[model samples]
Target: MKKIFVYGSLMSGLDTDGNMNGAKLVHADCRTLHKYAMYIYEDYPFIFEGRSNYQIKGELYEVPADVLKHLDAYEGDFYFRKLAEIECGEETVSAFVYFGRGHFFGMKEVKGGDYRAFRGKDGN
Candidate 1:
């Protein structure tokens, strides 16, 4: 099983149109870890390495290897997946994280690093 971390549209329970549907996702749970920063890129959130202190919150889902291809296609050229370690409860698990490739200069950073909470406050 391949474990992947989704913080933006693909985050489970988010009412976004880009969410992965019909994908057999399992062992899903919310988790937070360090070493990245999330920003409002266009209409959604984009995360990339370059910041510290802020812990990124997202859902970790276990899926089949083939699911990665679908996710890649769903993510499109704007994102590329990479392996990253995240804090799940008391343990750290290495999972695939999507890093945005599009330009995000001058965009507002999601200070809390929690997309859901950011959406609730800013309506994105």
Candidate 2:
């Protein structure tokens, strides 16, 4: 299994039937990192972009490689999977971070709204 960090739809039960699908929820934590901004791309949930001081709240999940591949596909064109360090409880761990692409070129600020407080089956 591979360890990964999820901040957007994946963490909010928007995808994967609200059970984290098949991924194992290791834990949740507040993580801040350099050079990253969050945005709701095309209004289809939020995705990270650019490099900034923005700290995104997220959950750490231990998932199979296959499942990770599925997530990569789900993130689609505007994201590239990159390894990142996230604070998990008393320790900091390395996980995957999705960086925005193409259409998201030149974005530098965090957008309005957030997925961390989102609810409902529709992921809105």
Candidate 3:
């Protein structure tokens, strides 16, 4: 099973069509080991490693090889897929996380580290 961590629109209920169509959700409270900052750009969310105490709220999904390829194609140049160890409840598992590789300037930071909450904001 190919495990992946999704922090933004890829999470369940966020994407209407469902990015993880054939995948199974493994954990609902997956978080990154390292700190990172998240911002909303063009109504979408991006997370980059930097000076922030935010743990990056997301979910862990176990997908098939075919599903992984589809996700890679969907992300494209928007992000760089990297291996990361995420904390899932009492266990720490290695999963693939997409780090934003594009230039983001003056983007609004999602203070709570949760994309869903950010989307619920007034101007979001």
TM-score of each: 0.81, 0.73, 0.88
lDDT of 3: 0.83
lDDT of model 2, residue 23: 87
Ranking by lDDT: 3, 1, 2
- Candidate 2, residue 26: Cα displacement in angstroms equals 0.4
Looking at model 1, which ten-residue stretch has the lowest summed lDDT? 17-26
User: Which ranges in model 3 have alpha carbons more than 4 Å from their true place?
Assistant: 121-124
Model 3 worst lDDT run, 10 consecutive residues: 115-124
Q: What is the C-alpha lDDT profile of model 2 across 1-124, one tens digit per residue?
A: 9888777667645554354578888886546454455665444444555546466767788989788878877778767888888886678888887666654544434442235654333344
lDDT of 3 by residue, 1-124 (tens): 8899998888877753277899999998889887788888886777886567598888899999999999889888978898888998889989999888865777887897888777763212
Of the two candidates 1 and 3, the one with more favorable TM-score, higher being better, is 3
After TM-score superposition, what is the CA distance of residue 89 in candidate 3 from its true location, in Å? 1.0
**Which candidate ranks first by lDDT, i.e. highest?**
3
Deviation in Å, model 2, residue 65 alpha carbon: 1.4
lDDT of each: 0.73, 0.65, 0.83
- Please, what are the lDDT tens digits per residue for candidate 1 over residues 36-115? 77788667788877767467887787767667788888788878888888887778888888887865577788887888
